[model samples]
Target: MVVDVVKRCFRVFKKANESTGKILGNMIKVQELRRLWGICHMDWVTGLPPGSDKSYNACLVIVDRFSKTQIFFPCCKDDTAMDTAPLIWNRVVSWTGIFTNLISERDPTFN
Candidate 1:
């Protein structure tokens, strides 16, 4: 019996780029966009294998509308409102200083 020593990489997901035209279509006034960019949008990502407790991890998405820049944060699953609240506040404040608004979607775990 002959064994092959080569290892193959797996394609776990599909990839596609958002077109420039699509980005241009979403544009707003530059100044207002700058103000909006100061705010952050956060959401928790869940849903994984039933037996995999590690799926409890949270994801924080920060978007700057003006620059169209985005940053992501991966946090622990066991984090609570008290814990997460401060963490999110500190992170955004540090990056953008005083932001006028913050947007967050309801996460099932926090309930």
Candidate 2:
């Protein structure tokens, strides 16, 4: 019957697709978490025109890896390490004290 032929063809197609879909490579190794506030990740988000504060066009987001606590700091688009250093000092370092590791994506602002 036509239905039987269609089902057979569909099974063959599915088997072929499944074989082609598998990845033949090693997987990425994940880093081990050691302690609270040990690793802090930082990143900047931009593209907002400006807020009511007028001075800030972006935000700096910091996350503690172990605790998963986050802090958001309002920042200008042009702010560099010189500007962000004090903000990190006042907002994060003051509260968490010194941490062992800091992780961030390659961003010019963090440099």
Q: Could you list the CA RMSD of all candidates, in the order they appear? A: 14.2, 5.2
Tell how far residue 5 is off in model 1, in angstroms.
70
What is the TM-score of each predicted model, taking all chains together?
A: 0.49, 0.68
Worst lDDT run of 10 residues, candidate 1, spans 6-15
Assess the local accuracy of residue 94 in candidate 1 as a C-alpha lDDT between 0 and 100: 70
Predicted model with the maximum TM-score: 2
True-vs-predicted CA distance for residue 96, candidate 1, Å: 1.1
Best by lDDT: 2
lDDT of 2 by residue, 22-52 (tens): 5768754536788877788888899878989
Q: Give the Cα error of residue 75 in candidate 1, in Å.
A: 1.0
In candidate 1, position 51 carries an lDDT of 34
lDDT of 2: 0.84
Stretches of model 1 off by over 4 angstroms after superposition: 1-36, 48-56, 109-111
What's each prediction's clash count?
1, 0
